[model samples]
Target: MLAKQRYNKILELLDKDGIVHTAELVKLMGVSSETVRKDLEYLDNQGRLSRVHGGAVPVDIGTTPDMPGGYISLQIRNSQHLEQKSAITAKAASMVEEGQIIALDYGSTSQMMALTLKERFHRLTVVTNSIQNALILAENPGITIILTGGVLNRDEYTLVNDFSATLESIHIDIMFMTVTGIDPVVGCTDQRLSEIRIQNQLHQSASRTIVLADSSKFGKASLIKICPFEEIDTIITDGGITPLMEEKIRKTGTRLIIS
Candidate 1:
């Protein structure tokens, strides 16, 4: 068929399944694999879809490429980067020791880290400002959950209040934080302005801060700055991070762990 027909078909498949693979599209369209790849590339370039390794995924919802940082709903963000976030959080969970008081910040990655922590650790204390993370670990009898009292941010499901007083008495072994953006030069940033104070408090409360950011978050600066690279102890991300960015991160004296 014509290229326009092929493009329409690909979009139809993407809408139906949320993703479409090259091989599947080729078979459906009776087109060569090269033709399918070119089609996907065209859609990706036109901002209609995102081309992945074997397939094309729906354009990321709630954020644009030009402005890499924006307020994405928790549900939409959770479904966007499953593999990378899972790998990153699995690595984050591995860094935790038994019975340590760990602080978890609010985000999809931090929520996944909560699940990993629940599965891996038997006895531990989790301090968090995220309602979702708290609920995820609440069922574990051995895992103590502490919620930082703050105003509720319904969109993000995060509590936003000055946590300095609450965290003053709490000794956090490690803080597994998440951010909307991670730039080697700009440091860590988030779309929400209200959470900045709490984030800084979490940083000060923890003896060590381990940021859980996916590779997509690298090289971007969001609306507001949370902290600089010097304040972060380490960052855990997936293999998608670029070598040049990795080198830049390491040069800031912050450890980079690629999962």
Candidate 2:
């Protein structure tokens, strides 16, 4: 594998097991022990993981939006995985029907999905907490945007209010959401606690819940877990997902769609 793929694989392993031994990684990655050590050192320098005695542990990044070197901003995230997210959102948008009441949660991927939906469908009702998503779809006259009213989270560009009551009254045909991580055991997780609750409420309100995540999210676990894979109706991700990671999610009885 290339250095980038190797780096992602190593991070995924760390997210899955919390720790990784250099010897095991050498075997898993089909590289030399020296190569594994160098990879770990590079990741350690990037603050992605903590290098230790003959091994490394996953770092607690993406937990807070304000912490320096820890938080991943929306702009940075939206710019990072452009091609992968484009494919994922295109596939996600194709799954939606015209005039269906859709719920979009706050995230970079969801914003991309909103853009896709606006271009593809002429008539639809979209309920979202993302200020950016609402603004993106507002340009389309045929689409009706419902901004979930709440405390505006400036950093994330999301509304952070209790959505339990609002969602209870509305029926959502489908909800496309994003996650910070997707550890096989931990299922779906995010960095913010408020978003986690809102995501859960949206999941309950929607007739179908489809998670929009790229391959990088697999095997990782964030600060707050939303639900297990079984609870999610489907997961739409890019082709970068590893076979092992795909198998793990499939075993949870959640349908996996590779974009």
Candidate 3:
């Protein structure tokens, strides 16, 4: 196949699945790995796609109007652990009670939490920056949803920037946060500085901070550290979390709830 045909086909696959791994593309195109890599590089340069660790994702997804300087679109081309994220969210939502005010972070994991909570809880106030989360709760009359006002991040469907500073004025019973990476030593982290600032404020203002993450997040480090493990009041994860990891987290004196 011509290079142009192969490139267009790759994009077609990405549009259908939201991601295209290098190995998969190589096998599909019956081409060398180097050739696949070159195609991905070419697509990225053309602003047609964004290359991730092992794959390429669409660039326009979750793009914001007022994007900060040097801000690249954030997309998860690989959704390998989505099931695990749902499990973790389900377990975390079970901990919430009616009439409690909760602060929810943006991301797929927290989105699952919002969905679970919508079915389980009634008469609660939920504050979140995620447009998806807000819409999920909007259908329920028993839940009062508050969305943070800020520049909308289309990539993640969350609000960020100076408007996040407003979180400091409000009090919440619990904060359910999700991060791109979590280190037993370095704590929670995200790729964007604006997100880090908002997470920090939420951590400080909430009475309790609970981190909801899957095993894939463990040991990875992002560009910015939002909070240390000690600052986290509780961690809810799936059974895929290793025993050693649980021990390391426990040593920090943070409650670990494994589902």
Q: Could you give the candidate ranking by TM-score, starting with the highest?
A: 2, 1, 3
Candidates' TM-scores? 0.75, 0.76, 0.73
Off by over 4 Å in 2: 1-69
What TM value does model 1 have?
A: 0.75
User: Which candidate, 2 or 3, has the higher TM-score?
Assistant: 2
Runs of candidate 3 exceeding 4 Å displacement: 1-80
lDDT by residue (tens digit), candidate 3, 1-259: 8999998999898776666778778888899999999999999999998777667767865233332212333344225467787788888888788899999888777777888899998789999888888999987899998888899876777788887666889999999998867887888887666666677777788999999888867766667778887788888888888888888888888888877
Kindly give the stretch of ten consecutive residues in candidate 1 with the minimal lDDT sum: 62-71
Q: For residue 105, what is the lDDT in candidate 3?
A: 80
lDDT tens readout by residue for model 1, 1-259: 9999999999997775456668778889999999999998998899998776667777874343333332345676677679999999888888889989999888788888989998888999988888999999987889999888888877778888764486887899998889878998899988777777787888898999999998978887778788898888889999999999999999999999999
Deviation in angstroms for 200 in model 2?
Answer: 1.3
Worst 10 residues of 2 by lDDT: 61-70
Give candidate 1 regions above 4 Å deviation.
1-69
